[model samples]
Structures are given as structure tokens and as C-alpha cells.
Target: MKRSTKITMVVSAAVVTGLLVLALPAMIGATTWVTGVFGAGSGSPAATEPPNPTADPASDDGLVDLGDGISVPAGGPGECTSTAHISTMSTRTDDSGPYYSKLIGDLVDRGPSELASGQALTDEAGGVYAYEVAAGDSAIAIGERFCIDYITVQSHNHVRAGMIHAGNILYLRPDPTLPWVSPYEPFDVQPGEQTGPYYDAIDFMRNAVVAQDLAEAQRVWAGLGPHIHPDARTIATRALEAGDWELLRQMFP
Candidate 1:
């Protein structure tokens, strides 16, 4: 996993944790509007610190491709809820009891989780990308790698000082001119195409995981065949993306 992505994962854990602990009912709203800049408005930098360098990557951690050359760190069944394997879900279960309702109501058409996993991250500062720093990396090096300038890397990533180290996650601001997709309207490839969910297998994967119905999730994949990436994939990849669809508080809260 790249350092930037790992940072996103860690930050997500922290933000979501804090959101649950401190905001509870407000979490849905907080995450939902946290990054309007990428979606519909401008996002100003907050006085935030980067992720701690002390943590180590989970052995099972890997990357989930979110299209547009954007990827986020993901985990195995235990770490990620992206896959269709119920066995990997954390031992944590709702004290109320197992959530056994159909993922989606009476919709053999889709899983509840699929219906619930919600939208994508097509909105935002145009569209942004997160970059992970490697060992021995420097600002200039990062700039060169992405074809951005060193000054912009420092400013965009909020690197006020200190050397770039391994495990540092950097948020790359997008060039506003470039076109990006919207999570809610991902099927805009042409004037009237609605096959994205069907073609990309998003509806298939999301419904399975959100429903926690691995069997059904797997079943859908079996039908997708080569259209799906070998990694399969996750509908949720970043914090803003998670918030846009209320996936965080609902899925893990």
C-alpha cells in the first residue's frame, strides 16, 4: 500500500472513531459534508496534522483501485469490508444481534448493502488523488513522480516542514481543468448510458458486502467473470467517498 493511502486508512479509522465517539448521530452529517470541495464546493485546508509514522502496515494490507489512477489501502477480510467473505468481518457484531434482514428489501435485484453502500467519489476539487511516500522520498522526488512541482507538492500536501518519510500520505490536488466523475452519477460515459453498475460490477460487489451476504456477493462475481478486476473491488475507498454515501457510520458504526 502507498503511504498516502495508508494515511487515509489510518485517518479514516481515527476520524470515524472520533465521529462515532464525539458526534454519534451527527456523524452522518459531518462526514457527508466534510469535503464539498471535491463534490460541489471549495474545500479549505484545516489545521490538521498528518498520520502518525509509528504504525506499521497490516500484513494483509493491499490497494483497492478507485479508477482514475487513484488507489486506497485496503485490508483482507478482517481489515476491509470490501470483499464478499463474511469470515473476514471483525468479531464485532451488533449487540442487538446479527443483522439478518435482506441486504435490500425484496430486491433479489440487489443486496441491502449494495443499496446502502451508496454513491462514489466522482465529486471534489475537480477530482483528487492521494500519493504515498516511499522510504528515502523527498518533496522534489514526489513532485517529479507525479509531474507536479515541488512547491505545489509541499503546499497541496500541507508539508510545512520536516523530511518526507516512508508511510507519509499526501493528498494531491487535481488540476481543475481535468474532467472527473461523480459518485452519484458514475454512468455518464455517454449521453444515455446506465450500464455502469451492471458493466463495472459495482452493484454486484456493493450489495454483497453491505448486506454481509458473502454468498450472494460471491455469486454475483461468478457471473461478472472477466469484467471484474482480479482484486474484485470495493465501492467505498476514501473518506469523502464513504461520507457521500453514509457508508461509514452505517457499515462500521
Candidate 2:
């Protein structure tokens, strides 16, 4: 081989090596970029599968376990027997005979029109009330106590599987105009804001006056003692005694 030819070959080989060195880094970088963008090859970690969706609460026949041994059906009352729903009444007790008597007298004077058309007087419907569930209090018992249907109680409060906790506020008397809704959509109002109990008491008094049964009115008044606010009870007691239905109306209104 000629010396000049050998030198030319060496220079060509060096240039080729230099090009390879420069291009190798760019090739590696391109591979890494492709891997990152497309998640190709075992060099990259496998993509995490999207987390499984949460289970729906309405599944499993929509039966709600309200703790205790009780379980009630959700949605509209389905084969819900009143006897099965009723439980022992709450142990709390109350007595305000004179006040009840006076209230009964007032209801007698006012007549059924006042009771029937509660909206006319207070701008609120009659028979709607808020009740905190007590231990052993079932939908039917609460309904019977308030002279309402157990199914109505369950449907109104959306009580699932007859499940009612002790502190849960059950609203009585659903709006007649509104379409039936699922249990997931509850009423917007809180327990304290509900005036149904007061009106319920008044209704019972009115019923007793209509039946001409002072004893029944007194019994209803006693049952209502625990449900009524102490302040409202005091005001009601005074108002009934003083024949100041206007004051009673103000409190209820």
C-alpha cells in the first residue's frame, strides 16, 4: 500500500468515527423521547390502569341498613305493612292538661276550615312536620302517632329499607304537587326549620275537639311534649291560656 493512501484511509476512518460519536447521542435522545411520548418498550413503566369506579349506593335492591336489626325498602312503599313498621313508642313523656284543654277549645271555635287549609292561615301546608327518630321508633309508629300513613312517612323521608337512625330527621307529609323523587335527593330544609310538629299538635287538638274528646286531646298533647321546643311550648301554653291564638299563629307562622 502507498503511504499517502494509508494516511487518507486513516483520516477517512477518523471522520467516520467522529460522525458516529456525534450521531449516537442524538439517536439515544430520540429513542428516549419516543419512549416517553408513546410509552413504548419495557424500558418505560407500564401505564397504571384507571382506578375502578365506585359502587353505586342504590345497588343491591336499594335496601338500606339503618343499623339495629331493621332494614327497610327504598323508594315508594312496596308491600310495607303498617304493623311491621310500627315499633314501641319513645319512652319520653309530657303533661300540660290545662293548656291542651284551652287549645282544644280554640280549635273548636276555629273549626275544620283552619285545619284543612293550613296554607291559607300560615302559608304552609298542614300535616307536614319534622321528627327526630328515636331508638325503636319505626316508620309506621311515627305515622300512626301523627295520624299519617307509614308508607307516606317512609316515602316522604326517603327512608331506605325501613332504616331510620335515632338522630335522623323524618319529614312528615310530602308535598302533594311534586313528583316522587329518589331517596338520594333529600329535602333541602334541616330538622329545626320544620314546623310540622307544632301544626301536627294543633291538628290533633282540632281532631279531638271535633270528636268532643278532651281526654284524647290531652293524650295527644302529652305525646307531643318531647317533640315541641321548650320555648315554643312555653309560648303555646301561655297563648292557649290567654286565648291569644294570634301569638300562637305568629310562632307557628
Candidate 3:
């Protein structure tokens, strides 16, 4: 009886060993799958990492394209504020004359007191001032009040001709010595059919000069090489080389 019991026990132990051997491979495979899912353990499937995103090339150089060949520094001028009293009126000019003619005529018609009364809140350095558009305010009238040319006001504020509305804030007297920075929206000027790309090119050149980016100004001039007149291109090239921002602004029609 003792001998038979020993044989049965031996057989049972051998069967148990065989079952463990058979289950070993499956246990290892399950462990490997878990490791792979958790991104751990050697020989596990390599985890696929997400690809890093690339930055905009223009942004790296701190430039933002404003379309129509105009590009400015990425971040514009700092916040501006003022507390100066602004006078409001309801004056409107006759639409009979040409736009430019009316603009000039209105400036001439304003008396000294009216001109003097057009005041703005000035900065500490007196290089810039904030002026609020009053009722019946025209670009030329605002320019006259601020003692600057209408074109300067228009270009600086990015105001379209005859588009000034009451309560619009305009920053005036940008320090020419400092780099050009505008808080206003980019000026959108389409090339006139008769004028060709002259206006667009001029606008770009003006912005480049105001930003004091000579290389960009030269690039703009070169891009317009084939379209603009030879004399105009020559003058523009000279102005760019001389760093003449005022000349570029004056080039506007």
C-alpha cells in the first residue's frame, strides 16, 4: 500500500511541473504586453512619441505680415493713454470740391482760435500725443489742429480718406528719431488700376522706413523694381539708402 501511494504522489508532482512549464510562456507574454502599454521594460514595443510642433519662421524674426506687401514688427506700440480735454463740434465740409482740394481748403478756412483750440493730451517727452476725434472732425482739420500735415495724420492713424469717425483715438507726433510703431490697424490700400502698384509699394516702403528697417525697405523697393517707374525707383532707392522716412511718406499720393 505504501509503495503504491508513493508512486501516485510522484505522478501527481510531475503533472504539476508540466502544467507550470506550459503556463510560463503565456505569463511572460502577458507581462510583456503590460510593459509595452505602460512604456516600460526592455524588448517591449517602442512607444511612439508625439512629434513636436514647428514655429512660424516669420514669428521667430519678430515680423508680422499685414498683407499687400506690408509687414511690421510682431508686437506693435505700447498702450497709450491721455487725459487732455477734447473739443467737439458739428462742422462738415462741402463735398463739391475734390477731396484733396476740400482737405486743404478746410485747413485754410479755420481761424487761429479754432486751430489753437484743437488740443491733445501729450506724453511726458512731448514726442507723442493722444487726440480724440470730435463730432464733424476731418483728417485735415485734425491735422491742422495738431500742427501736422493731413497726410501724416492719415498715414499715422491708418485712416482712410474721409473715414474719421467721432470718438476715434488718434496718436499723433510720433518721434521720428524713434522706431515707428503704430497702435492702429494696418492700412489696406489696393493698387489703383491707373496707378499700378505704386501706392502699395510706397506704403510698404513707408512702413519699413518708419520701423527703421533699411534691409526690409530695400527688399520692398527691389520687389517693386519692375512695376514702378525708373525715376521713382531711383528716388526710392536713394531715399531708402539715406534712411529717409519722411521722403517715403511724402511719396504717397
Candidate 4:
């Protein structure tokens, strides 16, 4: 063959090879392959992975200090409970007058079912603090003891005529809401502001606690961690000192 004809044939083969390489990816997959040559239009290493939902509370290198010693990465709820349950009145539950005293007695003489309703309530909803109840305690008094609104307690638990009964399970609200204001997404209010949406979110969480939805309760608590006000820090401090981690996890600096 002539030298010029041989050169033309070689150039045609090279062009075909380049086109085949470009079309190979699309042939292998149904989706169109439009990636730029080399590294063009590629994602960064960080974009390839999902963000971590669980974090170690101990690490605080990049956290911001919000003053008065409050900071992000302060932490979240402590260990979660294995299972969620509430107590129901059994045949032996006392129904006599002075139900509060009987309730206390029932707690003192609790069985080996390994029941700890106080801890259960705390884990499920971050309500209720003391492991024991008083002889003369009413729903209102219980609320007062825990530093929550009496109405909030009564409303949350569906109490009627302020009546008391032995062996009845109650959720406690030991911390005041002011100190740990939250910027949680559900409660879309200014850091220090308390508006309609905030209260709605609170009601949603309260209902979740009453319903014993542990997962939902924890989620809301985490979102509300940043709006805590300094004035209410004392109340928050007391609750944390008492180990009310579920509620404590909701407050922000």
C-alpha cells in the first residue's frame, strides 16, 4: 500500500478507539455518563459519606463556648434504657383512702420484676425526678416538687379531680423550661424567645413522653439544646445534678 493511504488508515483507527472509550461507560450502565475527563465535576471526599448521628460527648475540640461555661458538645442524653414500660395497677394494688401512703408503701415493697418507674419515666420522657412519692402528694404538689407547672403535670398525665391512687405510674418534670431554651428545629423561635411554635413543639414532646415514644422524645430533646437561658440555668443545674439526662439533653447554651 501507498505511504499516504497507510497513514490515513492509522488515523481513522485512533479516532474510533477514542470514541469507543467515551461510549463504554454509558453502554455498561443505563444512566447517562457525563463526568468530566480526569477529576472534573467530581465530588469531594467529604460528600461521599453520611454525617454521623451519634457522637462522643467527651470530644470538644471544635465546640463554641456560649459563655457562663456553657458550650456546644456539652453532651446529650446519657445511656438509653433497654425497654420502655409503664406500671399498671395489679389486683393487690391498694385502693383504700390515703392512696399516696399506699403508693409509697408499694414502692418500698416493690417486687423483683426489676421495676423502677421513676427511672423509666426519666428515660422515656425526662419527666419526674424522685424515686419515691410523699403521703400527701397530689398531681399539683408533685409538679411543684419537680419545679414544673402544676397545670403541665395535670394536663400531661390526664389526671382527674386531682385524685391519687396507689401503684399509679406518674411522669415527673423536675426542671424548669426557662433555663434550657432550645433552638431545636421543631421549636422555631429566636434563641431567647418563647412563641407559639415553641409551645407547640413542647406540647408535641410532652405528648410523646406521655405516649412512651422513647425515640421521638430523644430526638426533640436533642434539637432543643441551644436556647437555654442563663436565668434558668440553676434549675437546669439542679436537674442535671440529679441525673435528669433526658431533659438535660434538650437545653442549648
lDDT of all the models against the reference?
0.30, 0.32, 0.37, 0.30
Best by lDDT: 3
Clash pairs, candidate 3, are: none
Q: Write the per-residue lDDT of candidate 3 for residues 80-192, one digit (tens) a residue.
A: 12111111111123211111110111111122233233334333222223455666667655655434355545544545554766655554533221112221211221343
Q: Give the TM-score of candidate 3.
A: 0.30
Model 3, stretches more than 4 Å misplaced? Answer: 1-137, 143-200
lDDT of 2 by residue, 1-253 (tens): 3212221232223132221211111111001112222354312111121122223243384544332212344442344332211111111222121111000000010111211211111111111234445556665455434433455345334455677666554433221211222222112224446556554665565455345455664576576544554534554454445544322222221
Model 1 lDDT per residue over 127-196, tens place = 3233445556665544433333344334323343535555444434332221111112222234465755
Better by lDDT, candidate 4 or 1: 1
Regions of model 1 farther than 4 Å from truth? 1-32, 35-128, 174-253
The per-residue C-alpha lDDT of model 3 at residue 185 equals: 15
* TM-score for each candidate, following the candidate numbering: 0.24, 0.23, 0.30, 0.23
Model 4 gets an lDDT of 0.30
Off by over 4 Å in 2: 1-128, 176-180, 184-253
Q: Show the lowest summed lDDT stretch of 10 residues, model 2.
A: 100-109
TM-score head-to-head 2 vs 3, winner: 3
lDDT of 4 by residue, 1-253 (tens): 3212221232223132221211111211011111212223421111011112334344445333332222233343222222111111111222110000001101111111212222112221122232233344554444322333334333223333455444344533222112223222221234555455654555555555545565665566454333333333344444434444333333321
